[model samples]
Target: MVKERNKSFIFYFFVALTFMMTSLFPSSGYAAESNILDLEAKSAILVDAKTGLILYEKDAETALPTASMTKMMSEYLVLEAINNGKISWDQETGISEYVYKISQNRSLSNVPLRSDYQYNVKELYESMAIYSANGSTIALAELIAGSETNFVKMMNEKAAELGLENYKFVNSTGLNNQDLYGNHPDGTGAEEENLMSAKDTAKLAFHLLNDYPEVLDTASIPKSVFRDGTDDRTEMPNWNWMLPTLSFAYEGVDGLKTGTTDLAGYCFTGTAEKNGVRLITVVMKTNNYQERFGNTKKLLDYGFSNYEMQEIVPEGFQVKEQETLPVVKGKDKEVEIESTNAISILMKRGEKELYQPVVTIDEKLLTTEGALTAPVEKGTKVGTLTIEYTGENTLKFLTEKGDDLIKSDVVTTSNIEKSNWFVLFMQAIGGFFADIWTNAADGIKGLF
Candidate 1:
């Protein structure tokens, strides 16, 4: 009997251990493993174009070589100059010796500029935008700042102004200074490449798209002829393969930039819109050209699939327990307060309940016990209602200065006037009599 009991005990112990191991380490067919969306890139980020809300990130803050992606900053400054009337689309600018020599290097992305010929701003911009032409980018830099050196200063300054935190702009074209053959911009080493974090790169792209949306018109062109009907005509094909006209066409994809170098691998800043929701994504240092777009698709797909623009709080929404504020010396005793606008945010699907509305009244405007003064007009601003997220994942935006919470103005729903003097006096008398009656009743109860 003892031997039999020992055998059963050992058998049960092994069975329990096997069960524990299986529970801790599931097989490849586990359902939970299917939910993970991983990217094959060094660093990546996804953002909502409308709200600047970061939806996903992986090592996004680490600064890395950005290669030709630096041209997005150049594109921004060029558009800014045009908007400020400092430059014009028809303005003709002659190429410098440095630009002309770079243009002749067919090995690099260029549109062979003639030393004696001047090109209009529009064509040069198209070449740079569509073909990622290094020479055209340099020419535009010189045209804007009189030299690449001054342009580099402007890039850094604009990066700061745009709230880009981790970045260093060494050159405009995103090329290694050594690629410029000793004629690179001043104050930068020959081997140094422009560096920017994936987060900052997304911020720069966000600002570029927001400030100068017209850039999309040029950036979306699939193919264009540089200097058409002229001797310098060159077929410029967009490097962004995700465009609808490209081999790896993705719906709603358009108007961004791509970068490649030995150090930077293949990087891309891509944007797309579907069903009125737009997403911006950046993938840096992918192994190959195809992999960059592949990883971008993964990020975009995951964002669109898992999240959506949800109107969590409707317009004129009132916070619970904060629906009204007492009004002193007013026609009415209290006034209703509500949100000025609807609160909409990109939220994970099925997680709307995780967000709660928080109302903060202007303390100075409030009297004792959160009462407002009389003569409050309809639509008068009272306080702000901000949405607070209560979920596991921490929310972040493209810029540090960006407000993480979605806020709307809290305002009075109706007008309230001061009570007439006669009405006030009558109320005071009524209150005095009521107090005497309450004291008398209390004494009678004590006697009983």
Candidate 2:
């Protein structure tokens, strides 16, 4: 009997312990997860290409080595130089000895360059953009700024102008300074590598696409021969395998840059457009070439499936209490106001109703009583109407200067002319008599 009781007690004790453990530490299936994505990368982000709205992010602000992806800034500067007329497509430039040595390394992504030969700006840029050629990148940097050191300065300055945060540019090429064969740009450490946050990477890509969309024309080329028909010609396959013609061809995917290094692992900045909605994604520090693209696919899939460009508030919308503003000493008592343009944002599915419109009138244009002065013209700029989202998972734009996102101009719908002096005098007289009658009526009621 005692043995039976002991066995029963032990079984009950074990059962109690199991229940306690289950309650204390819930399974992943029952736990509350903050991230919607299951990415296999150290850091990642998804952004709306048009609005710069960050749809999702995972440790996106932490700075990490960017590997060859640093070339995007170089590409931006090159495009800028071209557009500014500082350099033309057919402009010829000769390679420096440093660039020549880098080109012959063969181990690095490069095409053969001869010191005696002059290559046009277009061919060198194609080599850099499509193949991530370190030598060609430095050559373009030199062509624009006279030297790689001066070019590095230009890169950092442009980063600031573009609102890129948490970034450092040690070289025009993304290669580690050590790879520069003891000729690394002055004022930088020998072992230091280029660094940027995933958010900043997305921001850079954003400005690149928006500022110079023509970049896509070159970036989209999947395969081309550098110096084709020449003895030094070499095959240049785009590192971005997500191109429509590549092995990992994803629908609507094109025109991006990829990076790989010992510290950076595998990284990719990818963009895709489907149904007029373009999304840019960045994945950093993945295990291999495949993992970077795989993680990017997860981000893009989530964005394309869950979000869309939605016009939350129609154009010419009027706020309830702000429908009209009183005009002092005017022919009209009040002037109507409405939004000048439609307010649209990349919103998650079924969440459009959660956003509310907030209107702010310009205080300087109004009197102390919140009335506008007379002579308010039609289409006069009154103020601004902005949307405030009241839902979960609200992500901010990549830059703080994103006031234009989900915001619209509020202006007067009709003109208000000033009243004549005689009319104003008559209104004052009438108002005085109306006040007197009101006071008399109140006095009579009190007597009763």
Evaluate all candidate structures by whole-model CA lDDT and list the values in order: 0.88, 0.88
Residues 1-448, candidate 1: write the lDDT tens digits. 9999999999999999998655433332211222245678899888888778887778888999998899999999999999999999999999899999998999888899998988899989999999999999999999999999999999999999999889999999988888998997889998999999998999999999988988889888888888778887789899998998798789998869999989999999999989889899999999997899999998888778767799978998998889999998898999999998887988777778888899999999988677998989999999999877777655677765456447889999999998999988988899899999999999999998
Q: Would you estimate the TM-scores of all the predictions?
A: 0.88, 0.91
Among these predictions, the greatest TM-score belongs to 2
CA shift at 362, candidate 2, in angstroms?
A: 1.9
Error of 1 at 429 (Å): 4.7
In model 1, state the lDDT of residue 148. 96
Best by lDDT: 2
Tens-place lDDT per residue, model 2, 152-202, is: 999999999999889999998888889999988889999989999999999
* Shift of residue 69 alpha carbon in model 1, Å: 0.7
